[model samples]
Target: MGGQTAPLVWGADAEGGAPYVFYHRESGELVGFEVDLARALERRLGRPIVFRQYDFKRLVDGLERGDLDLVMNGLEVTPDRARRVRFTRPYYVFRLQLVVRKGESRCGDLACCVKAAARIGTLENSAASRLLADLGAVALLYDSQVTPFEDLQLGRLDALLLDVPIVRAFLPHWPDLVAVEPPIPGRGFYAIAVRKEDEALAAQLDEALAFLAATGELRAILERWGLWDQGQEELLPPGFSGSLAVSQGSSPPAGASPRRLLTLALLAKAALVTVALSLASMGLAVLTGLGVAVARLYGPGWLQAGALVYVEFFRGVPVLLLLYLLYFGLPAAWAALTGTPGLYISPFWTAVVGLGLTYAAYEAEIYRAALQAIPPTQWEAAASLGLSPKQTFVHVVLPQALRLVLPPSTSDFVALFKDTSLAGTITVVELAKQYQIISTSGADFRVLVEAGLITACLYLFMSVPVGHLARRWERRLASAR
Candidate 1:
């Protein structure tokens, strides 16, 4: 959408992992088949190719928004997607691969996994995920390509169905994992996707792809990444053996409206999860925080120091890192300590505990401040009433501090509600993740916008009442005073 002289901006997800667009560990540079192909396309078009990172699910939305000229990641050719954007000629052919832990025997093949209703992991909105759905296997969707393999090794997933390229790239690093022979049935094509109206850009990209294929440059790129094979032959001369009907402007099929309704329902359900997670986390935060605050203010010197360390350490670490540690690291640590192999924690509770612990530190500080804000005369008054230390603290100091901290506590609860989106990283599939999944599956940009608006409104619906209650309580306390 930029001027002719502007760089051709392409979108990709570096977290998509190797053989696609991913960061090179040793060199600390982005490198992959797509990176090489983009460079080749730049040379062919005589324009600079600029790479922009995005979540793989949002790449199409970026294209629709005119933020990117095209997306060249491992975007597949699908009818739902075809209705949204024009795809370049198929650049690479890929097949779904089923992976299992090295000694797994219960579900060795796709059929076996399907028959067993085994829990299979795959990328959200991917062909493999759809296949799992059709086959009646329980599908666990992930945002990152490499995470399924980790879950497979951890026994969290019974099997993993993903693109062959991803399996090839990651299997070397996971010796305990193996791909089933003869990958899943059917093949998919990876291509560049452009906005539907970008006919000129699409033509230029197709021309460049034809040239690359003819001159063996495309094969060289794929081969360099260990991705070239007989499947790639289909992309050679006479160009794009696959059907080109997707390039034509096509509307979503009739009765697609129900899908939007279903999407809304999913979002609603996820919003409930968000509310429950946030409320539980806040409750835990309040209780733990009160204890820590009391320890820091009134406990023995050693206990106070310990409470201080807890607050500083939790406050310093990021919540996302904490979620990852609690979800993945904790089990591994438990295994090492107790010589147990499968010490797993469910994603929901892990999110609750991780969020609770991280926010407890902030809650501790808030309560501490509110407790300190109480005047010395209040304690003297309680003492003059012949109240014991514990009774005075409980009956007078605690109640006043609770009232003072109400507004800030409400603010933290709202913040924690939004922070629940981070739970998606651990595969909790709360409101934000539901929006992403719906956006990826929908055929229209309007659908994306609508889903996003609905998500935002739902968040507000849950958070606004807490704030109103806090204000009402503040006013009542003032009136009573």
Candidate 2:
């Protein structure tokens, strides 16, 4: 347990996890119902509260890893999750809400939305998603709660399914959106979760929650956020609305075979996404790199300087930062400037352009080094043989440079394959993100282990052949020398 001297650290995705935990842009401070609750709990426990930001899907992982003492970011108590984390008594009860553009007729309720086969969007690992899956709805799963609503506003989605409180938080911002007359059927309870082994901390949290409920503090907190409702009114204890019993661990499904076929299939699909993106981006990088190398080596002085700046700027910045700028920032700026609705780059193309351009900078440097390594006398010799500069580059310089750059290029390809995982931040569902979704959705550690192994094997499969080819080329080049 965290003592008075130590901070009570909780995990949250403040950037995307709004209403639950978020940074107030105007005040430059973290403010939300959960933030307030954490502060109140801190006072009760005689410790400072620390909100550690993480991806919503990774919050539990942070708690399990001991990077966090608890998680309070609207985490629902699910059987799968109960297997991994012992949850405190529920502090809030919420339902799934169906949201659509105001006055939309065809798909308002859950039954109608399912009947119409409308394109719905929801958070990937939420109970809402599993319900949508069971209903056989065509759902676009998003990592960020913000994204699906954004898409809904832009008409990219026919409906948005999310927690009731989340919908309420968002309705004030998007006037065109409206929740259905009633929320969806099932209720989800939010609780602070701790690792199952941490019984002492779990007990502390439960006790604190009990005190908050008894004192009317919890009800005040919920009302302050506009999260108090009739369901909550019926659910709290005497002074409050309601609370659920503490959760025990949920064991794996009884009939689950160790075959892991479905898990492998899911991993294979994601691996294909990784491979396709990598290959396409590599192709673009090679073309751009050749152009950059040519410009730096043979173009005018200003062109050479500009080429150098482009290469250095991209190489200096991290790929993830670059991706964020292009995927979120660039499109937002475009939409703002043009006043265009739904005019944004897809995550797929964003990854392709962002990764291609970033890697091109590195590729350019590789090509430049390889180009420079070739004797200047070779160009002179080609000129003496009546070859033009273009002819010399095509027939002489490029051929030799390609061989020289092969080994490093092969390594870059492998690195890029791994880096595609970064696209998950921008909502590209590559192998690593798929693994996260599947493992957490099932609350099965076995899926995580098997998925990780599959990803590793696939990466190795892709790179080993390239490595062998590079070595063979090295031997050939050495023999020629």
Candidate 3:
């Protein structure tokens, strides 16, 4: 940081940063090359450097926002980035390589649709990611340190694009991970970047770098971290990036082949269908539940008794067990009604019906409570004014009951948000379905976390207005009293 204001410095001492910038398997301390290098730079400048340990991608974004004064992580300077940002002297040499899951392989034009069209996720803010962009592949920047590698370890990503040393470092720990060698892209060195205006400071940093290069201090540090070996050569693992026929995935200008694209399209479309069917089933279930509640409250004793039996049975059963009955067992009943052999219904639709019906039982009780809670005198007064019994209930009782139900309705919707996830058991697609897709296809847990967070936020958004209305009605009622 310049003498003006010491902006926070963000770095990730992760990946194969062992003995230098390694990740603690337990407590997660930031160690390794980037870690020590930042401290060394601080000592030379005679200023305290505020180090923020994070993932590689966050460091890059923070740097772009000027939120970070510097990033000393395993960053590589690339041609695309060169035109956008300024760079410090080469910190170390690292090559990019491909990592694939064990027992899984793909075949294609390597440059056209299927090969080029694969969804490759890699660590954020690394040289390998930069190479991915340069190659014009559809590269998804996965979470830093933890997830990028975890996904690779878990079989989520097609393959990970990582540094030569990093790939080597993780290999001993994960026996299933395989690296693609021989055909490494044009080799490049790692560097720290700053905005163009930081040229003055960049010059100062370059001078400091030059001095470090001359004193063998940098090399000593690198050697200590195990980054530098004999003859200044990087420790090469079994794989190399240079020799492989680096199959570039299809770019925007390089559209993927039709079949692979169609597979992905179908994946997304199926998710939509599941959610749509679930919502439709929920709509029907809500109406049926509402009618049953109203009938139980107002209909003749026999009808009320029947409604009670329906509500109690559904409410007593576990949602999952109930769903199984509807999905697997209801075909016979459906066929009996239709005079067919075994009636066929989609699993997604069945899930919607089961979940909605189960929830509706609870909702019906809430609605019943709303109607019953209205003062009996209000109904009597409406009748005294010559209003019909139906008019008395509708015009006088329903409005107050609706207002009374607002808070519980909010709570119900929150419950609904969570219940929707359960639909995944019966094959209904929603947020949970999206999570499964990300898990099976990319195999990343961050997507699940992200989707869960998004769903939580959606519930929060949904609840806010209801909460507001509850408060507003409470105030209105208090004022009238």
Candidate 4:
């Protein structure tokens, strides 16, 4: 991950990005306003620009880890971010636009949306979320900018708050959606981010940016993408002070007060969602595992081979990949192949199916091992007693096998609970996503520390009860034997 001595690496996430830094649809080559700006900056510094792609939420950590020398991913200039990294002059100034489904006249502006108590969607850790939170709206935080629009199209959300450039880029493609009037004023500006320790590099980037603005080169790049607007002209005038282009955010200082209690309550609710998802997924996994184990043990030869392959395939692939496949890849494939509108699976069922099928692979092995561990004599004895094969298995073998698999099954369930955190990627508001939204909106890092502590405690709390029950059942079964 170290790139300090190499070409100047800039981190960006291409997903959900359009005119910012994304691949051209027809050419399939990366080209965007930010991409061009990065190249120009690279030339100014006498270094090649190496673009390292990452998830939008991960850009900050990537920069902090030295995985990138700079981040030019439309990273917003905020007081909270300023504490952790040095930001170059504002390269782009943007406002938040409220997008709604066309012909929906319930809310015409941001104020009306808030007054109606609508379910608003926005990027999870952005200034938009902070605004929604202040407005006391039910903010549906998302990892990608696209999902909010998709949800809006389907009537799942009342409005979407996103950057003006993003709305302009995606709106033309979605005829059913339109931007509501009175766009939210600029909350901040986009800037290149440098690690706080790399002050010299930050200064150099700031100088290059100032020069670019003065020469109109930056404006040209933005204009080519149809993103040049009065917002940039007013916020980042030519030859402006790059070092002090923006100051502290308008939001009040973050601290521990009643807000801490509110955050905890929200985390608790999110924890419940995590638990419910884990329980449902575990239920499906157990049933699937039983079917898989039985197929491998007693079914026809081909069925046994098929079951084995299923187990191996799922266990080998990562759960996150499985989720993406089910949530995004499958739907797109279905739409393309059938020439139909894209299929949209509810986030809840998507999480259940993805986690369930993936864990079933491991559970199948656990069940098979337990069944094999039981002596063959029990089956023979039951057969000799004139019991039918099905009854013999149900009455004699199944009970013992259940007890044998209990402990490990409990362990797997515990693991499944924590893995539910990955559901955040598909737009599920589980504990981890809630933590992210809360942690980012505030400036104090200690609040995040407190949030982390509570998360660990919650995991421990859930696992301990299951472990105790498993031990109790095991001892009872042992004594009965």
TM-score of each: 0.53, 0.55, 0.44, 0.53
Displacement of residue 315 (Cα, Å) in model 1 is 23
Clashing pairs in 2: 235-241, 235-242, 236-241, 236-242, 237-241
TM-score of 3: 0.44
Give the C-alpha lDDT of model 3: 0.59
Q: Which of candidates 3 and 4 is the stronger one according to TM-score?
A: 4
Looking at candidate 4, the ten consecutive residues that score lowest on lDDT are 249-258
Candidate 4: segments with Cα more than 4 A from true spot: 1-5, 235-481
**By descending lDDT, how would the candidates be arranged?**
1, 4, 2, 3
lDDT of 1 by residue, 1-481 (tens): 2346568889876546566764332233556678888878887788898987555766776576555799988999999999999998999999998989888887789999988878899999999988878877899998765557667888999999989887777676577888899887679999999999999999999998987887778877776667887888998896444322111111112212112322556778889999999988998999999999999999999999999999999999999999878766776688789887454666788889999998999999999999999998999999999999899889899888988899888999999999999987766778887676555332234645787899989999999998998999899987876
Model 1: lowest-lDDT 10 consecutive positions: 246-255
- Local accuracy of candidate 3 as per-residue lDDT tens digits, 209-301: 655555555665665545564423332333322321211111111121111111233334544554465456557666877788898999999
What lDDT score goes with residue 249 in model 1? 14
What ordering of candidates by TM-score runs from best to worst?
Answer: 2, 1, 4, 3
The lDDT leader among the candidates is: 1
**How would you encode candidate 4's per-residue C-alpha lDDT over 323-395 as one tens digit per residue?**
8788767766886899774566767799999999998998999999998988999989998999998998898
Question: What is candidate 2's TM-score against the reference?
Answer: 0.55
- The collision pairs in model 4 are none
Best TM-score among the predictions, by candidate number? 2
lDDT of 2 by residue, 15-63 (tens): 4534666433333255677877887787777778787655676677556
Report lDDT per candidate: 0.79, 0.76, 0.59, 0.77
Off by over 4 Å in 1: 1-3, 238-481
Error of 4 at 366 (Å): 5.7
